[model samples]
Each structure stands twice: as structure tokens, then as C-alpha cells.
Target: MSTNRQLVSVDYEIFGNVQGVCFRMYTEDHGKKLGVVGWVMNTREGSVKGQVQGPADKVDEMKQWLRTTGSPSSRIDRAEFSNQRDVPDLELRGFSTRYH
Candidate 1:
């Protein structure tokens, strides 16, 4: 067992009308506001994908935001998350929007 499993990481993809609607922008803002570290980018397949790492509660809040609320002009069909695990420390620093 390890200590400080309080940190967790997760990968997420938001589907439907996400692109071209500033989804990444809002995600970045919300992530930063939540004090989570990760990156969000627009996928080639027309979805938004990213990784988030932080305290479990913060991550959960981010997940909820990703699932239910996005940009004002965006319509979310669903959100899919994967690769969830507890980490001893955060692997990333600060939240931002990835260009690539």
C-alpha cells in the first residue's frame, strides 16, 4: 500500500457538439478554478479529450463538470472516462489547453 492515495488521475472524452464551441476553453478555466492539473484538447475525431489529476474530490468535481456542464454553446451528449487510478503525487502541473 502507499500513502497519499488521495491523489487520482483520469482520462476523459466528451462527446457531441463539443468542438468549435469553446469546450476546451471552459474546461481549462474550470480545471484551473478547481485547482486541478491536466490538459484538454480537441480530438481529430471531433470530440474533446484530456487527462486530469489532483485530489480525489477535486477530480470528482472536474468529472462532474465535464459530464454535465461545458461551454454555453456546447451540447453534451455524454462523457466517457477511463484510466482511473490513485497516484502518490500529481503527474502534471496546472491546467491548460493543448494545441496538438
Candidate 2:
């Protein structure tokens, strides 16, 4: 990390028992509840990948939710987050799921 500034958006890859669970749906719902915009999708590697954008603090809270409250059937091992800054413009309109 070069500079420490407010992060407007973030990218994440959630690992462990994250697949085969309705993680994407829960994530989308949670993001909307937190007033964030992003997309979550199932990766071929049995992981979940997504990006969330909003106020810095809300984004952090959303990240925490992703790391903790995955679907009831899912066990979240960890959520690796990045791109903590450098978002000049919010790209996502609303939280959604991408099928791949």
C-alpha cells in the first residue's frame, strides 16, 4: 500500500466453503442494505468474487459482512480484499449477481 486514504470501492475474493451456497444472493442483499453498489459472482475456482462501492465506511462495513455473515449454509473462511482506493468514479449502479 502506498498511501492511506478513504476507499470508495473494493474488490474481494471470498474463500472456503463459499461455493454451493447462496453467497451471491446474500451478498447482494447485504450490499443493498448497506447502501452499496457492486456485483458478486461465483468463480470457476469455487470462490466468490465481487466489487463493492460506496462511502468508505459503509464499504468497510460491507466487507466485514462479507467476511462474517455469509449465507446460513456457508462457512466463510476469509474474504481477501483489495483496491482500497483509486476509485475516481463509482462504476456499479446497484448490487447484483453475475452468472458465469
Candidate 3:
């Protein structure tokens, strides 16, 4: 039988008018629906930061959704993605708004 390995982590910095909108909530909803495990939050720099761990294909799908149709009221200026192998486990029970 084949072993099921945990997928690598993907860190993304989504810029543009991601703040003041329901970007985080949308992202969380979409991510969870896509079977991704992570948390999304607004940074102090008016950007949204999120890390998703799942199969590579699913992660790519999540990224695309975030860039295109996730935030209807926001414009996605930039989306930077990177592979992270050492990210700690996260307990993303629900979507939350963080003030920093």
C-alpha cells in the first residue's frame, strides 16, 4: 500500500484592496471547501497573508481562487507564492479577523 504523506506548505502574500473586505472570510471558506488546512488573516500593511497545506493541485486551485474570484470587492494586485517545508502545524478551526 502507498503511504499518505502530508503535503508541503505554501505561503502566499495577496496584495491589493484585500483589507476592509471579506477577503479573509472568503479565503477561509474556499480553502476549507478545497480541503486545505490553514488560516488567513489581514496584516498591518493592508495585505492578506495565508498558508495552506494540502495536495499540490489543491493548493494551486486555492491560489487561483484567491487571485481571481475569492474577493469580489477587492483587486488582486499581486500574489506571491513560496514553498515552505518547515511551517508549524496550525489549528484553523474557523476564520477570524485579526488586528495588528
Candidate 4:
């Protein structure tokens, strides 16, 4: 069996009731737990946006989590994923929440 794993990167923006709901915190925790590296931040437009990169399966799992589940008080109306591509290796070191 092949020991090498395929990696992928994706950009996502989540809409609806995401801001001020601990969404970025949960996202960072979940991404780390899933062994993925990424960053999440809140937008001024009242949404969440970030980029994730990791093994293909792990990335997929993270995507699902972003789409369906977030912080307890969060209401995820929709999630839009974009800029997906295959990468030779992980670009980021760890998951985190960005503040601006």
C-alpha cells in the first residue's frame, strides 16, 4: 500500500449567525483535533472566512464540520467553499483564529 497521503487546500466563507458566536474558536479547536492546519477569522460583514489545508480525508471532514456544525450559539445558514486545489504538502503549521 502507498504510504503517501494526498493533501488539499480550500478557502471557505460561512454565512449567517456566525459572528460573535465563538465560531472561530470552535473552528480552530476542531481543525486541530482533526489534525488539520488552518486559520479562521470573522469578517466585518458578519460572516466567517478562512483557509484549511491537510490530508484529503481530514480536509473533507473539516469541510463537513464547517458546513453543518459550528459553535453552540451559531446558526450556519450556508457555507461557500472555493479555491480548492491539491498541494504537495501542508503550508500552514497549526490551526488558529486571526484577529483584525
Best by TM-score: 4
Candidate 3 residue lDDT tens string, 1-100: 2222445577788989888778888888888788878778888888899778765567778878877776778888888887666334443544444456
TM-score of 4: 0.95
- 2 or 3, greater by lDDT: 2
Clashing pairs in 1: none
Better of 3 and 4 by lDDT: 4
Candidates sorted by TM-score, descending order?
4, 1, 2, 3
Task: Encode model 1's per-residue lDDT on 1-100: one tens digit a residue.
Answer: 3333489999999999999998999999999999999999998999999999998888999999999989999999999999999888889989989987
Alpha carbon lDDT at 78, candidate 2: 79
Give the C-alpha lDDT of model 4.
Answer: 0.94
Taking the tens digit of each residue's C-alpha lDDT, what string does model 2 give over 1-100?
4333344878899998988788888899999998888999999999999899887878888888888888999988878998777576677798999987
Candidate 4: pairs in clash: none
How many residue pairs clash per model? Answer: 0, 0, 0, 0
Q: What TM-score would each prediction reach against the true structure?
A: 0.93, 0.88, 0.78, 0.95
For each candidate, what is the lDDT? 0.93, 0.86, 0.74, 0.94
TM-score, candidate 1, is 0.93
